[model samples]
Target: MTWRLVRYELAMIRRNRHAWWTLLTLAALALLSFANLSLEAARANADKREVAAAERERWLGQGEKDPHSAAHYSIFAFKLSPTLATLDSGIEPFVGQSVWLEAHHQNDMLDRPQQKASLLQRAGLASPAGLILTFAPLVAFLLAFVAVAQDRERGTMRLALGASAHPRTIVRAKTLAIWGGMAALLVLPLAALALMVAAIGGRLDTDILLRVMAWTVLMSAYLALLAGIGIVVSLRAPNARIALVLLFALWIAMALVLPRTASSAVDALRPLPSSQAVRQQMLDEAAAYWTAEDTKRHQAQLLARYGVARLEDIPNARMAELDMVERHSHQVFDRVLGALYGRVADQDRLFSGLGFLSPTVAAQSLSASVAGSDFSHHHHFIVSAERYRRDLVNAMNADGMAHRADSNERHINDVRLWSAIPEFTYPEPTLGGTSGTAIPALVALALWLLAVTFLVDRAARRLMP
Candidate 1:
């Protein structure tokens, strides 16, 4: 009987021209977004790799020069894109592509994707995960909002009840039909999209396949929750119009407003200091720590320690002072940047805390984490880059000290020495790392779905017998 009811609902939906059109329009839009993303991902990765290779060759081919000069000619550490990011570019647009690893200083990554976008692209840039979370639920709601209430209004509900059919069973069939319809419209198109991406050499490896499947399951759950909400509204409202109005209001609150409000609240509660300001403070500290008087004192100490009368007689004198300055600068950067890292982590945690109030927040968080564009993944890459910079700079400084001599001696090394420095390599984060960061949001979403399902069942039972 339930199967027959479900089939009846499906057959009725097949006759709704407007619903079918809506599905078509949505699928078209999704394909456009994915197409841009697939090409862009391939191009961006290619450009980054190409530029990195050129830079590496440039470094190795830079002819013999002073170690200090070579240190200044720093290489860039390029971050490659993870395949999942093509589906949902989370925080990637906001962050930079590469960090310049140089001697004697730490650098923030530079050249974000957002930096290259025009005013219009910035305004309407679409994310697949974002689009699905925002609009798919609305599509589901539009289909199911009238599922029960319209039957009641038209008096078919009387026939349904008179047939000795349980209201719960009737509601279940309606919900199942609604969910299946939307899944067919949304999920099937996306599955086709995945295949197309693979055909275009998007590397549908095991990891990427796993992420796509996970994203699909998440979308399914979110849509199911929305469908249940719509059905519940339909069961409780006096008529279809009222059910739609209520559902629309809920959708606006959940999809449009809450996510922004939560993020803004986190920023307000734990404001971060400006990066430029922190850099300035580090500069001032370095200046104060290495004043003229301090340099003179250090020079005298080096002279006394070496038992030399004049600066020219002391070997490695300049290198010793550089060594001292480098150590002090490192300490300053570590202290200032460490504080900034802490503030960012705090903000991320606060935003994660608000996931229960807004499933969109949870969904975005999960998508970003899985795609390796979240704060955690980016931070790890940044930390790794900085570590590499430190090692590279320290090696150069050591070479400086080794080649140091009196003022007349000029220190230079063979260009082949550059090849000895290992290329910067950033490891792709593992699935476990993604899961760790996404777990909180995942849990929040599960709780929401469970809560909605419980309410829906209760509402279904309360419908007229």
Candidate 2:
């Protein structure tokens, strides 16, 4: 009986011209979004390679300089797009793409693509993930809101009740039919994305793919919950129009207003200091720590630590070597600034925690996490980049200390040393990392789905004879 009902519902939907047109419009939009992302990815990849190659050439061509001087010169590492990044884009478009790595002081990533793009691009060019996570649920709500209401309006509810078809079964069939349509709208583009990645020789981690798929499933569940809520509204309201207006109000609150409001609240409560402020503080601390009087004492301590009675007595480039120590001191100051920045980030997380009240917010956050486009994933890339910078700079500094002259030589000329520095390569976080960060949102989504399911069942029982 449920299967018959589902078939009937599918037939009814297929016969509706408006429904077909809506589906076609959604598919076309998804395809267009995918194409845009693909083009952006291609352009970004080309730019990265070109910049990297140019930097490498410049590094190789530098005049012979003390290893310490070379370390100070630094290099840049550009963030690469992850295999699934084109599908989501997330905050990546808003964040900088590259970081400068020197002996001391970590620079924040720079160049937000969103800031460079036009206003219309930012507002209307919905990411593929946005369409799936935000729009699909609304579509589901529209389809299911009139499921039982239309029956009641047409006097079919009486016929259905008399046919001995349980309301639960009827609702279940209708939900399944709507679910099928929503899934098609959501998954087709994602599947195409997977194929595109495969065709491009992109490395897709199985774990990450699974997490992405899980996010899609959760999104489907969220839509199911909305559909159930819509049915309840339909059953309670006097007309389909009223049910739709009520659903739209709920949608606006959940999908549009709540997440932004939560983020704004978090920023208000735990504001992040400007990047300029952070850099200025580091500079002030370095200047104060490297005063002439303090420098003499610091150099004395370095000589003592190396078991040398005088700076000149030490083998290798002692003055050149002291530069490395100064660089490390600057790095310590950077660490302090980084800690301050992290505190503000914790506050932002607390703000996002408020999304548990809205399933749309929860699902959107979870989907981005699973798709590796959330804040945590972005931070992961940043942390990794910093670590690489430290390693590369330290290696250059150590080389200078081991090979440069011990005398107060202002510079050690060594072009080869510059050529030896390793370039930065950003390794994207695995799916596990993204999924782990998204756990809170996923839990929230699950609870909401369960709550809605229970409510729908209770409501159906009330309607039963």
- The number of clashing residue pairs in model 1 is 0
Clashes of each: 0, 10
Q: Highest TM-score: which candidate?
A: 2
RMSD of 1: 3.1
TM-score of 2: 0.90
Clashing pairs in 1: none
lDDT of model 2, residue 460: 74
TM-scores for the candidates: 0.90, 0.90
Candidate 1 local lDDT, 308-403, one digit each (tens): 898777556777667667777789888888888878877776777678998878877876776667878888888889888877777776787876
Task: State the C-alpha lDDT per candidate.
Answer: 0.77, 0.69
Model 2 segments more than 4 A misplaced: 316-327, 330-334, 404-416, 434-436
Stretches of candidate 1 exceeding 4 Å from the true structure: 1-4, 118-125, 188-206, 287-290, 297-315, 434-438
Clashing pairs in 2: 64-413, 64-414, 64-415, 65-412, 65-414, 66-412, 316-405, 316-406, 317-404, 317-405
